[model samples]
Target: MDMEERVVGEVLVVRPVGKRIDASGSADFKGKMVDRINRGRNLIVLDLSDVDFIDSSGLGAIVSMLKTLGKKGELRIGGLKETVDSLFRLTRMDRVFRIHPSAEEAVLALAAAKSMAKAPA
Candidate 1:
């Protein structure tokens, strides 16, 4: 499973290049994401536009990544294609994640959230 990692301001955008994220690749995906979180990348946007398929293991892997953040950071998902979007909706993962239409929109949303967090109450 090949992934592209980039920084959009303070958020790290991770885009997996593969068409499928199944049991064969979930472990590696989780490992890489954990490593990134350990390295202090707390703000993230997972861009899944290129990915067309994911299994339960893949979904678990993503949920694991969110847990790994554990109040230290945020993980937003974006660019979900129709089938994947349906899966997320069906599984109720959409409610668990802040899904966006594009990576740029996800980054902007993160930025806005950060700004709001920094605002005085």
Candidate 2:
């Protein structure tokens, strides 16, 4: 699997270019995400539109990455196929993650949420 990353202001967009994100590729991607988070990149939007397939290993990788990100930062997954979407729901991970329709939407959602939190109640 191949991965590309771009930073849009404080938002980091990580796009994995591959047909599957299984054991063969999950480690590298997870490591890269961990590195980014360690570098103080908080807001991460994982663009999963290109990924039409993901197995248990891939899911585990993502779960691990989410933990590395912790509370100070977050990992928002976007553009899930129906199967992938169903997997998340079935695994009960949909509640743990913030899902977005697109990478742009994820970025915007984070911004809006941050603004709201900073605003007076």
**Model number with the top TM-score:** 1
lDDT of 2 by residue, 6-88 (tens): 88767889888897998888888778878888999988899998998888889998999889988888788888888898989
The TM-score between candidate 1 and the true structure equals 0.97
Query: Which 10-residue span in candidate 2 carries the lowest summed lDDT?
Result: 1-10
**What's the CA error at residue 23 for candidate 2, in Å?**
1.3
lDDT of each: 0.95, 0.86
TM-score of 2: 0.92
Q: Rate residue 93 of model 2 by lDDT.
A: 92
Model 2, CA-based lDDT: 0.86
Deviation (Å) of 31 in candidate 1: 0.2
For model 2, name the residue pairs that clash.
Answer: none
Model 1: how far is 11 from its true place, Å? 0.2
